[model samples]
Target chain A: SQTIHQWPATLVQPVGSPLSLECTVEGTSNPNLYWYRQAAGRGLQLLFYSVGIGQISSEVPQNLSASRPQDRQFILSSKKLLLSDSGFYLCAWVKTSGGDEQFFGPGTRLTVL
Target chain B: QKEVEQDPGPLSVPEGAIVSLNCTYSNSAFQYFMWYRQYSRKGPELLMYTYSSGNKEDGRFTAQVDKSSKYISLFIRDSQPSDSATYLCGPYGQNFVFGPGTRLSVLP
Candidate 1:
C-alpha cells in the first residue's frame, strides 16, 4: 500500500506572490508523480509529471512548474501567481512499472486574490 | 473534441436507488479504464480499475468497459448518501487522461 501527502491543505495568496506546495509519497520507490489542477466543475488538468528524480514533463504551458528533488518529494512552484491559479491542487502517484491507477493526496485548496 | 467525455451531472437520486455513470472517448488505444470518486474540494480517490473491454464488480460497485464503442460505465447498487461525490472516468495509457467528472448526490 502507498500513501500520498500534500500541504499546506489550504492557502490564500495575493496576486504576483510566490507559491510553493509540497507533496511526498511513502511506501513506494521510484514511483511516477504528477501535479493536477481542478477548476470549478472541470476535470483535472495535468501541470507536470515526473518519472524519476529531476525528470519532469509539462502537459500544459503555464506559469506553474514542478520539481522532483528527491525520489518521493515533489514540489509545485510559481514565481508569480495569477488569479487563475486558484483551484484545488492535487498530487497523484502511480506504480513505476505497474498499474495505471493513480493514488491521490488529500490536496491543497488555493485561493488567489 | 476531447479525448474523453463525461456529462458533468449534478445528478440527484434518492437513497437505495441504483446509480449509473458513464463516459465516452474517441481513442481506442486506451487499454486501462479507471473510476475515481472525489469529495468536494478533495482529491479524487480511485474506486475501480478495468483492463480493456470487460465487466468487473466490487461489492456494490460494478464497472463495465465497452471498447467497441469507446465507452465505460459504473453502476452503484443500493446507493447511499455517503456516496455523494463527483465521479470521474479515466482512460490511461503512458499516463492518465480524465473526464470532467459527474457530480452525484445520493440524497437520504
Candidate 2:
C-alpha cells in the first residue's frame, strides 16, 4: 500500500517569513504530484502539479512555488509569506497508471500572521 | 459561471436518515465525476467515482451522474454520525475541478 507523508502538520509563520512544506510518498515511483490550497468555502485551489522531477505546472501564480526533487519527494515553498497565504495546504498524488482518482495526504495547516 | 457548482449546505440530518448531495458542472468535456469526503482541517478523501452517465453503488453510498443534464449526485443510505463531514464533488477531464463542498452533520 502507498502512503503519503507531510511534515509540520501545523505551522504558524509571521508575515514576510519564509515557508517550506514537504511531501513524500512511499511505495510509489514517478507518480503525479499536486499542491492545493483549500480555504473555507473557497474550494480546493490547484497551486502546482508535477509530472516528473524538475517539471512543474503552476495553476495559480502567486507567492507559491513547488518542486519535485526526487521521484517521490515534492516541496512547496515561498520566499515571503502573506496573510492571505494562510490556508490548509494539501498534497495529493495520482498513480500514472491508475485512473483519475487522487490520493491525499493528511495535510498541513498553515497560519500566516 | 463556475466550472462546477454545489450548494454549500451545513445540512443537519438525524442519524439513519437518507442523505442526498448534488453538484452541477458546465463542462461537457468532464468524463469522470468523483465524490470526496473531508473532515475538519483534513485533506479530501476520494469516496467514489463514476464514468460517463449512470449509477455506481458501493456499500451504502450510491453515485449517480447524468451527463445530459451535467448533474451528479451522492446518496447515503442510513446515514450515521460518523458520516458528518464536508462532501465535495468534482468533474474530471484533463484535470479534476471541484465544488465548494457541502457540510453535512448527522445528529445522533
Candidate 3:
C-alpha cells in the first residue's frame, strides 16, 4: 500500500513571502510526481511534473517551482508569493510502470493575504 | 475549445435516486478514461477507470466510455448523502486532461 504525505495542511501567508510545500511518497520508488493548484470552482491546473530526480517540467509559467530532490521526495517552492497564489495545492504521484492512475495527497490550503 | 468539458452542475438529487455524471473530450487519441470523486475541501479520489469504449461496473458505480463520440459517463445507483461531492472525469492522452468537474449533492 502506497501513501502520499504533504505538510503544513493549512497555510496563511502575506504577499511576497517565501513559500515551501513538501510532498513525500512511501512504498513506491521512481514515481512520477506532479504539482497542481485548484482554485475555487475551477479545475486543477498543472504546475510542474518530475519524471526523475533533478528533472522537472513546468506546465504553466507562474511564481512557483518544483524540485525532485530524491526518488520519493518532491518540493514546491516560491521565492515570493502573490495574492493570486491562494488556492488548494495538491501533490500527486503516478507509478512509473507505464500506468496513468494517479494518487493524490491531502492538499495544502494556501491563503496569500 | 478545451480538451475536455463537463457541465459544472451543482446538481441536487434525493437520496436513493440514481445519479449520472458525464464528460466529453475532443481528443481521438485518448484511450483511457477515469472518474474521480472529491468531497468538500478534500483531494479527489479515483472512483473508476476504464479503457476504450463500453462500460465497467464496480459495486454501485458504473463507468461508461464511448470513443466514437468522445463521451464518458459515471452512474451511481442507490445514492447516499455520502455521495454528495464533486465528480471529475479525465481522458488520458499524453497526460490526464480533466474536466471542470460537476458538483453533485445527494440530499438526505
| Top of the candidates by lDDT | 1
Where is the poorest 10-residue window by lDDT in model 3 chain B?
A: B91-100
The residue-by-residue lDDT of candidate 1 on B1-108, one tens digit each, is: 899999999999999999999999888898889999998878899999998688999999999999998999999999999999999998897788999999999999
Give a tens-digit lDDT track for model 3, residues B4-66: 999999999999999999999998888889998888888888999998799999999999998
TM-score (chain A only) for the predictions, listed in order: 0.97, 0.97, 0.98
User: Residue B81 deviation, candidate 1, in Å?
Assistant: 0.7
What's the true lDDT of residue A54 in model 1?
Answer: 98
Off-target runs (Cα >4 Å) in candidate 3 are: none
Over the true interface, candidate 3 deviates by an RMSD, in Å, of: 0.9
- What order do candidates take by DockQ, descending? 1, 2, 3
On the 0 to 100 scale, the lDDT of residue B79 in model 3 is 97
Clashes of each: 0, 0, 0
lDDT by residue (tens digit), candidate 1, A32-106: 999999988799988899999999999999999899999999999999999999999999998888856799999
The TM-scores, one per candidate, come to 0.97, 0.97, 0.98
Cα lDDT, all candidates: 0.94, 0.93, 0.92
Candidate 2 displacement at residue A111 in angstroms? 0.4
**B1-102 in candidate 2: lDDT tens per residue?**
999999999999999999999999998988889999999988899999998799999999999999999999999999999999999999976766789999
